[model samples]
Target: MSNFEFQLAYTVKPHKPERDETDAALTRQHLREKLGLDTVEHIETTLLGSITLNNSTLADRKREAEKLVHDYIHDALKELRVLSTVKFYGCLMVDGLGPAIRFDILPK
Candidate 1:
């Protein structure tokens, strides 16, 4: 299993400012389910949000995990129209083998 810590930066449509919290909650739940993550949390304090994904087989590889997360967010945006550009920085835990591999998933 692999653990991932993600720092999320996203924009919501201008008109939907009031739904920010609701949208964020729904996004977190969606990611948890879609990624089959054991744990997902929204640790947002600043304008940027921090998310940690734990115990996920699907996220075992850094490159694949980045693509999966990016694609999932793209698909989720179709239903959750409040989301605009979404970007993230992901750190893949190396299980004490060495330093974690860091990757960035940027908006298209």
Candidate 2:
């Protein structure tokens, strides 16, 4: 089992009429189902938008997980037909080891 914590800062190009709570709920559900994440929480007071994920199998492999998430977000945006961009940051702790890996995503 792996412990992963992710912090995502994001912006949707065209704002939608839906409330932030509704958008957050939908995003959480989508990520939980698509990535098998145990936790997906939307953080308030973040610039534009933010989301966090904790304790997930997705972080079993640190580097791989980072890449997976980066690519996943890209594909998800395309799939949703939404012009959005995300800046992903994460810290992976395996078996109680503190901060095994810390990374930030950069545009390709």
Candidate 3:
């Protein structure tokens, strides 16, 4: 008896052509189809060629990513449902091999 949406963002890394396409498809399927969203909203991703350069700008980049993630989810939830109110939270992981910066929204 609940409706929910999830936004998953992940750092982009160099990949072989096949692997890259496969990864993208998988991410879309899991986040959109699995969650049953009408559409998969834009995923905020930055193209920092070297992981080292991104490290220096990590804080700023992450902040921007967070803002986009929240806004996308907030708007989508509002348009999708008539809820009393919707709640949102940004999930971040500083640890290596962490998940892409994303928002988990619950609208009821």
Candidate 4:
């Protein structure tokens, strides 16, 4: 088994009655800067977690990350279900959850 660090991101749908346009705009700005995207229209929030799994391939890790993201979206934040676009990013064998790991993940 190996340690996998995962980050889950999702954008709330604009049509939701509870959605705040201002909050969404701020979220979009924050995520665009964080993810280094040129432009992003939807509000995005990122959640981080770690899991140990038997798989070694990146494909397996990707599947596990997506599954984890889906489970979290379904269970913890049920409101996001069918109303949000989700993504997962994963890296193997992170040294620590501190600066070392974060520096490695940051875009160069």
Candidate 3 residue pairs in backbone clash: 9-100, 10-100
Instruction: Please give the range of 10 consecutive residues that has the lowest summed lDDT in model 3.
Output: 46-55
Which of candidates 2 and 4 reaches a greater TM-score?
4
Q: After the best TM-score superposition of candidate 2, give how far the Cα of residue 47 lies from its true spot, in angstroms.
A: 24
Root-mean-square deviation per candidate: 8.1, 8.8, 15.1, 11.1
1-100, model 1: which lDDT tens digit per residue?
4444443333322224454556656655565455444442454311222243443454445445455555655666556553443334445443322354
lDDT of 3 by residue, 1-108 (tens): 111133343332213444354543443344354433344246443211111113235465555555655565455545544222323344643333235665555444
Clashing pairs in 2: none
TM-score of model 2 (CA atoms):
0.35
Q: How far off is residue 16 in model 3, in Å?
A: 46
Clashing pairs in 1: none
TM-score: the better of candidates 1 and 4: 4
- Candidate 3: RMSD over Cα atoms? 15.1
lDDT of 2 by residue, 1-108 (tens): 333345443433223344243444454345445544444345521222123344354444545555555566656645643323333343434333245455544333
Model 4, position 48, has a per-residue lDDT of 52
Model-by-model lDDT, in order? 0.45, 0.42, 0.41, 0.41
Residue 1, candidate 2: C-alpha displacement in angstroms: 19
Candidate achieving the largest lDDT: 1
Error of 3 at 71 (Å): 0.5
